[model samples]
Target: MHDSSHHSVDPVLAVLRQYFGFEAFRGFQREVIDHLLAGQDAIALMPTGAGKSLCYQIPALLLPGMVVVISPLIALMQDQVAALWQNGIRAAFLNSTQSSQESAKVMQLARQGAIDLLYLAPERLLMEHSLTFLSQIPIVLFAIDEAHCVSQWGHDFRPEYLGLSVLSERFPTVPRLAVTATATALTRDDIIKYLKLQQAKLFIASFDRPNIHYTVVAKNDPKQQLKRFLDAEHLHDAGIVYCLSRKRVEEIAEWLVQNGRRALPYHAGLDKETRQRNQSQFLQEEGVIIVATIAFGMGIDKPDVRFVAHLDLPKSLEGYCQEIGRAGRDGLPANAFLTYGYEDVIKLRRLLINSQLTENLARSARQQLDTMLAYCETTNCRRQMLLRHFNEAYSHACGNCDNCRAPVSTWDGSIAAQKALSCVYRTGQRFGVEHLIDVLLGKKTERIIALEHMQLSTFGIGSDLDARQWRSVFRQLIAADLLVIEPVYGGLRLTERCRPVLRGEQAIRFRQDAKAPIAVKKDVQAKRGTLSVHHHSKELWQTLKKLRQDIARQQGVPAYCIFHDATLQELIDKRPITEQDLSKIYGIGSRKLKEYGADLLRIMKQFAPDGIDV
Candidate 1:
């Protein structure tokens, strides 16, 4: 119900106020929108929760013809289109997930000029029929979401994304926008080449999600540690638990369900119907925790996810950031919790060696893994170290991370480092961490006895440190680049970086491992509400949620599609009575006011006598 004929000094802000109910553009949104509105191509490198969509969406509304958005997943397309419809914007998608009749109707709409924004998966959009159909339409611009997938160096590289370059070739006159959340120097260059955005104006937003309290703990009784994290903060909240394998996903999902949590498993291995059902449950319901592999992340549009925990390490820091970035998308305080150990490293390295990825890709993956390990072992400010990996600088320590919250103590570990390096060297530089640990602890197992006389001079020299402590030293050595995992045999080998330590020319310092379970953010939920709402009355909050849920269920969309929890919270705080006042609330746009404002205001009026304030 936006007034397209209304002319104002700043047309974009007028549209934003009419549609989004927000007073200002976040970060580089207005700049990207300005570039596209000026008939120039652009690239936006923004973080996950950043308003990257608005950068193109606003321009689409003001442009002459419909803008085609190239999205990655079918789930993402459906979620976005549903949300768009709620805001009174005309949007649709075509993919394999839809029936031919449904697709034909959307095509009919496009041909009839009844659609504003149309989304397509890369593979579908690049099809000959799809290209031919677009050629006849009055097309305007192209927006490529998740552009990092176009780069081979990116964590989730998709061959289909390479086909997107044809968009520039086929629609030569149309401007384009390539948007992504995480990309390294190599991936950024690759996106430019693949998307032909070399001449586009680039907008790089800061990658920091300051609201996320980062915490990484060494794996010790992982199940208990996870439970404590849940109980301490997100006991009944919706969150994601990422596992490295499908089996672990299933196991964790089952365990959580058995232990009185609403949990579900999602992975490629699950049958199509099961996967869809689990995903639907996660999106449509609240307080439902999803335990899944990396496969579950790309299309998650849920705004109120309270936490992202890693039971095992991710392949790279890029992947880690993207996954954890799923949390706190609503701009409320959230958490990124991880529990890892040396065993996790060994398993992942071995898997990498056995996988059939190309040699070039394998080398890149190894480097990414090494960087990720080093990050986990870092005792400095987590945010500063993480941002540095992205080639960005943070001038000061971020007090939100675990390292900054609880300053870890450092101690001299030169002797321990020397002993671990010597054991790797003395054992022919071929044995794995377990074997090395056995030798260091002077355990004469059958394999050790057969391979050695138990008489190597370095064999029992490391008995002063316990096995766990010795494992920590080895893990840290790997993190320090002093040791490398032999790809073929999954053994430890010395790197040149270890030479100084071996020769007693350099001293090593290590952070004493924090023995306690994860440190909980005591006032995190209190600062943000228990339900991530700002209201004090739990009863009124639940009532508003129930109303939103009812409307969303009737509309056959996620509850957030009706109005985000943030908007509901504002309704509580503002206690708007009239349509004009309702229009002033965040997320309550003109179209939403026409559609749901009556119901919302009616609900608020009933509770007005209670004098509630969010």
Candidate 2:
């Protein structure tokens, strides 16, 4: 008989090898997985594409029985189930789109211990019937996707999600896992308390995606800016164009299709079928673009999206990161472009001020918005600034972003920064950016005259720079850690870091903020090191993919479940000759080698002699 210990390999590593087919775990996946496998609750704060799904999915598969996943959006649930089905996994979902009969069938399967995973909306989980149904099943784990929604202090809080604490009392024995792409320290605490997962292990992955190039441009003809961005960066790649309004989504989708691109529109305004059809087209077709609002892409499972462009200011940096995370999941290079005007700030502030939340909550939300605005206006490395907001330090600039690729020139701003800091000090650190700019520009406006600040020694020291230039200086000062904005007081203040610059002991350099250069149109050139396989070898790869697809389809699994992109690349590169050689490849264990190994070997032999000797 097989030893139980051999069967009981580290539960996390076992799932990594069996389902996801990775030989090892990535960044906190092993730790988080182990925590959940030990039947402890967990809250994982990983960035997009950081394998958040694996943390729960692995533990669910490894435990004694079924794992119930509570998701927010129906589209997200369907997409996840479809991807899992392609991988030969028995996963199903109960959402609004399902017919009652279909829901009943899925419930029956769950009762018989046949289904391994089940997905439901948070509201559905709160239903009495749903609770009754769940109580009958041997649920080993309860997973909450997008756990930030549980906190009203979070950007995407949902009331139904707040009610999810019932799961803790209803099934006290099951471990719980809460996963989100982004969360601040306060939001993290709120999630634990609200979900009643106080005992959960906390895993916070580095909030960095080095492969995504972040860029923010001034809102100069945003439509034209978007057109230029798509033309220069992602002409024939999958991407999402986010808008704040439904009308804008429709217009952008139409414009993209008219410009010889495949595009679709998605929002709550559309009927369910239309939205689903558009989403399906985007998933199945190459180079398809989806123009959408914030309502789209919550749980989307697309792996090769090449870009995510925002036509207006995002609600928060967390939202922005989550949206861009949709791209480059396949470990490929991608881009995130954002454009916003001054009016966006006014509109966002009004939205926040109109909310009925407590004053402290609104204040926190506004601060988060200010941080996002600072990011947009920054001339420094966008990646560095973003990571810094999450309390993580980035020592070097990412060489891929638009700013880093073409760095902005810097001027000696030590004197100007000192003058600004002095003005804030003289004014008792209680003035906003406009008042500060007026003092520097030496404007004889009524407000300035009323304050009688023109007579101060540092009043007119910065008269050389205009309003826009002064704005850039202040933004840079904040980014450089010299100035701090207190949202509570609605004013600017100096941090201790500014003392050295004021004393002339530290020199301050500022990026000369200027308009982005107009990209000259050029003929497309092939990327270097991207190989064009021989026609025979190309056929072999295609045959291998077809075989994998056929087996996955027959087994009701995801295509990646059979072979990941890296594994496929290895097969093309190594062309393993024997079953022994095949077994040595990553993701190809003895069982998989025996099952599909000969077919791949035969295809390789048809194209090359000896079929890559072991």
Clashes per candidate (backbone, < 3 Å): 1, 10
List candidate 1 segments past 4 Å from native.
1-9, 444-453, 528-536, 609-614
Would you estimate the TM-scores of all the predictions?
0.94, 0.77
- Specify the highest-TM-score model's number: 1
Candidate 2 regions exceeding 4 Å error are 1-12, 353-357, 412-510, 514-614
Error of 1 at 546 (Å): 1.0
TM-score of 1: 0.94
- Residues 211-313, candidate 2: write the lDDT tens digits: 7777777666787898887887677678999998899899989988888889899998999899988987776555789999988887677776878999989
Which residue pairs does candidate 2 place in steric collision?
A: 41-200, 85-557, 85-558, 86-557, 86-558, 86-559, 87-557, 87-558, 88-557, 88-558
lDDT of 1: 0.87
lDDT string for model 1 (480-593, tens) is: 999988866779999988988989999999978877754455565476445545445566788899998999889899998888878877887788988989989988888888
In model 2, the Cα lDDT at residue 240 comes to: 95
